[model samples]
Target chain A: MTPLLECRSVTKRFGGLAAVDDVSCVVEEGSVTAVIGPNGAGKTTFFNCVSSIYPATSGEVRFEGVDVTRLAPHVVTRLGIARTFQNIRLFRGMSALENVITARHCRTKAGVVASLLRLPSQRREEAESEAIARELLAFVGVAKWADSAAGSLPYGDQRRLEIARALATEPSLLLLDEPAAGMNPRESQDLVELIRRISKRGLTVLLIEHHMKVVMGISTHIVVLDHGVKIADGTPEAVRNDSKVIEAYLGKEDVT
Target chain B: MRDRIVRLLVATLAAFLLALPVASLRGNSSTGFTIVWTPAFVTAAMVLVGGAILFAAVEAQRRGTAFWDARAATDSAVGRRRPCAAQAWTLGVLVATVAALPLLGLPGAWTKLLLETMVFATIAVGLQITIGMAGLLVLGHAAFWAVGAYTFGLLTVHQGWNFWIAFPAAGVAAALTGLVIGLPALRLRGDYLAVVTLGFGEAVRWVIKNEQDVTGGDANLPGNIVPGSFRKPMGALGEWLWQPAAVDGRTFEPGTVQALIDRECYWFALVLLVVCVACVHLLAKSRVGRALFALREDETAAKCMGIDTTRVKLVAFMASALWAGLAGVVPAVHRGSINPEMFDFNTSVLFVAMVVLGGLGSITGSIVGAALLWMLPALLANWFPEVQEYRYLFFGALMAAMMVVRPEGLFGGARRKGAA
Candidate 1:
C-alpha cells in the first residue's frame, strides 16, 4: 500500500542553523514509526516541517498523496493528520471530556449558526461527541477523570489524555512528539502498550522521542536523525545497531 | 458566600437609597434627599446577617480549616471539574439583574444607567477575549468599540441603513482592524503589546476626533439608527407595551423611547452577551480554543503540538476585535449618537482591567467582571448621586486595590490552568 505520509528532503533553517536539514522519511499505513535522535538533532523540527507547523526552507511533505508542505496545521489536521506535543498542551481550564471533544471539532458538521442556535441536530452531535470522548478517554485509561480539569490530571494521565485528544480528531496519521518524555519506567512501559493498542486501531503512528528503550520496544520501523539529516532507517534492531546511530547519540569517545 | 451575602446586603441598602430620585419628582430642592429603603432590601439585609452567623457557626463546627478543598495537582490521578460556586452565583445574579433592568427602560430614561452598564459589559466581554483567552494585553481595546460605533453611525446616518445591517458591518470593520493590529503585535510581547494596543486605540480616537467631517469630533455625530422592523409591528408584546395612558401622562406608558430605551438596550445587549458567552465557551472547547489556551499557557508547547502560534494569536486578536466592534454599535443606537471622545484610552484601560480582574481565560469570570464593572457605577450613582461624580475614581482605585490584594477579581478561576 502507498505510504500514509511521506517527507522528501525536508529542510528548515533558523539563521545559520540548519535545524532540520535534508531529512526524508515515509510513514506507512498500519505501522508504528519512530524518529529518535539526541538533543539538537532536529527530530521535532523535522516533524514540524512535515506537518507544516514550520514552512520548510526546502523539500515537500505528502499526506495521502497530496503535497501538504504548504498546508497550515489545522488544514493538515483536516487532511487526516493529528499531533500531540512533546510537552503536554491541553486546554488547561477545560475538562478532560472537553479536551477530547475539542479534537472532535475537526469532524463536526455544525455550521457557526447551528452551533450558536444550539439546534437539536447540533445538540445531538454534541452528545454523541461527548460519548465518543468518554470512550476515547477510557480507551486511553483516563475515563475516570473524564470530567476532571485537564490541567489538574496526573502527569502520566496527562500524556494519555493528550493521546486521547489527538485520537478524537479521527486522524489516519498521528504525530506524537516525545510521548515518552518525563515518563517513569512503569509509565513508559505502559505507553509502549498504549502505542501498540493505538496502532491496532488503524492509526499510522509517527513518534519523536529520545527514549531509547521505549523507542526500540514498540517501533515497527525506526529512523534516526542527526542535525535534521536522516542517518539511518530500518527495523528497530537494525537501526539501533547502526554505527551512525550510536555516533549520533553517544559522543565519539563513548561511541567506540 | 456568607461574607459576600453580608457585603450584598450592605450594597443593597445603599442601592435602595440611591435609586430614590434625587430632587424629587416635584423638583422641590427644599424637600431634601429622602431615604426610601424598599422592603425587599430589608429581606436582603436579614439574609446577610443570617448568612454571616450561619456561616460562622457552620465553619466553627466543621473539621476542615477552609470552605474549599485544595485543588488537585497535575501529579494527582484524580481529576475533578471543580466548578467555582462563587462565580456561578455572581453570574446568575448579574444576568438576572441585567435582564430585569430593562423594566427601568420603559420609563424613558436615556442611557438607563443599567442599560449603559449592560453596554459596557458587552465591551468588557470583548476585551476579556483578548486579555483572558489569548493573554494579549490590549491597552486600547475601546478603539474597536469606536470602530464599531463609527461604522454603524456613519452607515445609518448617511445611508439610512437598518440597525441590524450596520451592526454586523461595524463588527467586521473592527475585526479587520484587529487583524491589522495583530501585524504589529507579531513583533511585540507583554508590556510592549499593551503599549502598542494603547497607541492603536489612541490613534483610532485621534482619527475620529481629527476627521471632523465624518465623526463630528467633540460635536459628535447624531445617530438615530431605527430598526426598519420597528415599524413592522411589535405584535402582541408591542401592543401590550404601547397601550395608551390610563390616569394621566404621569401614569406608566410604554410608547416613549425613555421607557423603551432601557429595555431595548437590555435585550440588544443580552442577545450579544449570550453570543459572546457561547463563542468564548465554544472556542474554549475546540481545537482553535485549545490552541489559544496553549499559547497562553506556553507558546513553545503549543508550537510543538503542531499549532502555529502566530496563526492562533491572530485568530484570537480578530475574535476579540470583532466582539468589541459588536459592543460599540449598541451604544450608538442606545445614545442616538457616536462621540469620538467615547472611544478613548480610559475606555481601553477599563476593558483590560475587567479581564485582569476577572481571571484570564475564564469566560464566566469575564462576564461577571463585565457585569460587575458595568453595573457598579450605575448602581452607585443611582443610590448615591452625591458620590456619582467621583464614581470612576473610586472604581479605578477599588480595581487597583483588588488587584493588589486579590489580583483575581470576585469570580476569577484557574485561568489557562486546566486539564493539561
Candidate 2:
C-alpha cells in the first residue's frame, strides 16, 4: 500500500545554510511517526517543508499521492495535513472554542452573502462547526476552557487546545511540533495516551518531540536526525540501538 | 459609610478639577488663562460636581460597594448567549429621540447638524469593518467616500439618472474603487499598509482636484447650477398618505415645505443608520467575522487554520467601501453639490478617530463615537462661542485622555472571558 505522505530528498536552504538537507522519508497510513533530534536537529524545519510553510527548495512533498509542494499553507491544510507550531500559536484573544471553529473554516462553505443574510444553510453549517469544535475540545480534555481566551489557558491545556484546533481541520495527518516541550511528566503521559487515542481513530500523526519517553511510548515508527541530516529510520527499538543515533544524541565516543 | 463619603468627596474634587479648562478662558499675550467665575460658569460647575457626587453615592448604595470597583460586577452578562434587552432598549430610545427631533420643530441649523451627524455615524460604522474587525488600518477611507459622492454627483448631474438609480450606482463605484486599492495594498501589513492607503487617499483627491471639467476640480461638481434632480422629493405616494393641515388648503410656504422635506431626509438617514448597524451586527456574529477576528489576532495561525487572508481582507475592504459609497449619496443629495474638499484626508482621519474612540470592534461604539466627536464641537460652539479657537485643542486633549484612560474604548466588548 502507498504511504500517506512521501518526501523525496527535500532540501530547504536559507542563504548558505541547509536547514533540512536532502532528507527523504515516508509516513505510512494509520501510524504515529515521530521525528526526534537534539536541539537544532532540523526536525521542525523538515515539518515546515512538508506543511508548505517554507516549501522545500529542491524536492517534492506528496500527500495522498498528490504533489502539494508548492501549495499554500492553507491549501496544504485543506488537503488534510494540519500542523501545530513549536511555540504554541493559538489565537490569543479569541475564545478556545472560537480557535477550533476558525480551524473548521475550510470545511464550512458559507460565504459573505450567506453569512450576512444568515441563510438557513449558513446557520446550520455554523451550528455544525460549533458542535464539532466542542466535541474536539472535549476529546483533547480542554472542554472547560472552551469559553476562556486561548491565551489564558495553562501551558499543558494550551498544547492540548492546539491539538484540538489542528484536529478541527479533519486532517488525515496531524503534525505536532514540540507539543510536550513545556509539559510535565504527567502531562506528557496524558499526551501519549491522547496520541494513542488519535491513532486508534485511524488518523496518521507526524510529531516532532524531544521527550524520549513520550516519543518511544507512542510512536510506531521513528526517524532520527542530527545536523540537518537523517541518520536512522526504523522502529523505536532499532533506532534506540543505532550507533549513529546514539552518537548524535551523545557526543561521539572519544578513544585516547 | 465613612469610606463612601470620602470617595464621593474625592470624586467631586476630581470632577471640579477636570472642568476647570472648560469653565475658564484664555487672555491675550500678558495674562495667561483665568477662571471665568461668571454666574453661568459657577452654576455649571456646581451642577457638574453635584451630579458626580450624587451618581457615585447612588451607585455605591445600589451595588453595596465602591462604584468604581468593576470586578464586583457579575460576569454572567459578559458572554451570555442571549441578545441583551438593555442594549436593544437603549438603541430604540436613542433612535426614537433622533426621529422626533426634527418633527419637534428643531431649528434649521440643529436639524442640519443632526443630519450631518447621522451621515458621519454611518461612515464610521462602515469603517469599523476594515479597521476594527479585520484590523486593517485604512487611512484613506475618505477616498472611497469621495468616490461614492462623485459617482452620485456625476450620474445625477451629467447622466441625468434618477436618485434611486444613482444611489446604488455610487455604492457600486466605491466598492470597485475599494477592490482596486485592496488588491495591491492588502499585500502590505500594519504601518506600511497604512501609509499606502494614506497615499491612495491623497492621490484620489488630487485626481479629482486636477480633473477640472470632469469633477469641477477644487470648485465643486455641477459647478454652475445645483441640480434639483439630486433632491429626493417625497413622491405622490408620500403626499397622499399624510397631508398636514398647514399645507393642505393653502399654497405651500417654502419654509414649511423645506422643513417637511428636511424631516423626510432626517428619517431617511435614520433608517440608513439602522440598516448599517444591523448589517454590521449580523456580520460580526458570522463565520467571516470569526475569520477576521482570527486574522487580527494572528495571521499565520489563521492561514494554517485554512483562512484565505487576502480574500477575507478584500471582503472587509469591499464591504466597508460599499457602506461609505452608500453614505456618500446622502451628503451629495443633502448639499445638492459635491466638493473634493469634503472628502479630504482630514475627514478620513475624523472617521478613523470615531472608530478608535468608540471602541475598535463595538458597533454601537462607532455610532456613539461619531455622534460625540461630530456634535460635541458644534454644540460647544453654539453654547460657548468664546472657546471657538480652542475646539480642536480640546478634541486633541479629549482623545489623548481617552487613550490613556480607556484604550479599549467606551463600549469595547472585543475581549472575551469565561465566567469569572
By TM-score, the best candidate is 2
Q: List the residue pairs that clash in candidate 2.
A: none
DockQ of 2: 0.48
Query: Candidate 1's residue-wise lDDT over B158-187, tens digit each?
Result: 676666677789999999999999987976
Off by over 4 Å in 2: B1-90, B225-232, B236-257, B414-420
Model 2, C-alpha of B333: deviation from truth (Å): 0.9
Report the lDDT tens digits of candidate 2 across residue range A25-138. 999999899999999989999998998888899989999999999998889999999999998888877779988988999899898889778899999999999999999999
- The DockQ value obtained for model 1 is 0.19
Give the lowest summed-lDDT range of ten residues in model 2 chain B. Answer: B71-80
| Model 2 lDDT, full chain set | 0.78
lDDT of 1 at B347: 78
- TM-score, candidate number 2: 0.86
